[model samples]
Target: MPAVFILLRSLVIRLLSSRLAGSVAQFLRRTISTGAAHIGTALRHVWERIRSQESKEAVLGCVLCILNMHKKVET
Candidate 1:
């Protein structure tokens, strides 16, 4: 019936808008923070490698590795 259809639509809207649907902000914050922490650690490791007494070729290689990881373009 039309009335049943309207009731179902309203119920779906209410459920989607309610707090029981869960916090999108919380999910975003958690995902971003976790991803940022990983990137921070990776950068730290690369920085330490640069600061160490490694050869110039090795340091350049590390940086090149990072760039290539994202895009495989001819150097």
Candidate 2:
């Protein structure tokens, strides 16, 4: 019947939309976690260098390198 077909179609659409949304959310979570890890590692490295008597210029260079790497990743 037409009514049955319409009901089935709507159900399929709802299922597909929900699945798509879940996939997108998972992807975003992964991206956020990876970016956070990169930032943490960069900061830790910089901090260690500073504590070990590295020059200010050297620390600045390290920060710039990390930022450049991030720019490359974004593209």
RMSD of each: 5.6, 5.0
Evaluated against the true structure, the overall lDDT of model 2 is 0.85
- Over 44-66, each residue of candidate 2 has an lDDT whose tens digit, in order, gives 77677665455766877876887
- lDDT of candidates 1 onward, in order: 0.79, 0.85
Give the lowest summed-lDDT range of ten residues in model 1: 48-57
In order of appearance, the predictions have TM-scores of: 0.44, 0.65
Residue 69's lDDT within candidate 2 is 84
Predicted candidate 1 versus true structure: per-residue lDDT over 1-75, tens digit per residue: 999999999999998887554788778889999998998788677767665566656766876788589875688
Highest lDDT among the candidates is held by which one? 2
